[model samples]
Target: MRATRLNLMRAFAALVIVTLLAGCGFKLRGSNGSYRMPFHTIFLGVPDTSALGTELKRNLRAADDVVVLDKAEGADVQLVVISETRGRQILSLNNLGRVREYLLTYTFNFRVMDAKGAELLPATEITLKRSMEFNEQEVLAKEAEANLLYRDMQSDLVQQILRRLAAMKAPAPQASVPAK
Candidate 1:
């Protein structure tokens, strides 16, 4: 009878503690959730890089859990690309007038910012490309080539963005010294 009464008291105490904790709004987020920054809301400002901006927004939407916004209105971060350059080159050719080993390059500036629009990752350029045989006979095939190249470029851009996000690190925790 004593043990049962003690157990009941313990259970009542535990319930009271849980109720107090719940009233205080203490939430037990997951492990990964603890490290997550308040980065859910984002604003994208691309200037003349509108096309690339659209592609970036799509990639961020599909690959990241961020919510993109227009301008900096009610956002946690801002992503921007300042400039971009695109070029193409031919790497191979056949004796029968067939061209092969074409390469495409795209260089661009990127930046991440806080809600106040302060730069987090300073302006930087990332370049990516794709190369393939150039066929002059089939225009439809050339169109396919362009599509592939664009896809590669988008993939590369997405990788670069994710890399930046992963590279973010919080400040190191301070150590406490024990007095001898």
Candidate 2:
């Protein structure tokens, strides 16, 4: 009988602990206040219909937890990133007028929002830069390499989003006020 009573007491304590945790803002998602909703429907907004968009969609699909939606009306969440490609000067030519090195940079302005219109995560901007030695004879090969670099950059961007989302905290329940 005493053993049964002790087991019951332990169960009761566990229930209480769970209730308290629920009252607080603790969730399974991450440390930050982010909801772990099964956000299957996602709306992606990009500046233009480019390879980046295609690659981003493919990576998100591979995640299996997210579904890229065709429209924004009923999306569980939204991901918007304005990407701009720019030519960067990494190295200069010598006195003989021979090119040295160059870099290509792509900057993305990104954000993710929940369905309730709350800013789950504010817009965070990040840039991906790739540098390569200048070779006038192999410009085509370099351009091909640039595409591969962009693909890697897309993967990195996805990882950044996942990290930020994972670190979000869930909203805490409000305490009821007694009548005055």
**Best by TM-score, which number?**
2
Candidate 1 — worst ten consecutive residues by lDDT sum? 29-38
Q: Alpha-carbon error at 136 in model 1, in Å? A: 2.1
Q: For residue 96, what is the lDDT in candidate 1?
A: 72
- Maximum-lDDT candidate: 1
In model 1, the runs with Cα more than 4 Å from the true position are 1-38, 47-52, 58-65, 94-98, 169-180
Per-model lDDT:
0.70, 0.68
Tens digits of per-residue lDDT for model 2, 5-25: 999999999999999999997
Cα deviation at 78, candidate 2, in Å, is 0.9
lDDT of 1: 0.70
Q: Assess the local accuracy of residue 18 in candidate 2 as a C-alpha lDDT between 0 and 100.
A: 95
Instruction: Give model 2's TM-score versus the native structure.
Output: 0.62
Tens digits of per-residue lDDT, candidate 1, 1-180, equal: 999999999999999999999899887753222233336766777754566677667755654467778767677677776877777888888887667567888787777777655667788788887776676777698878877787678667766666675566422222455999
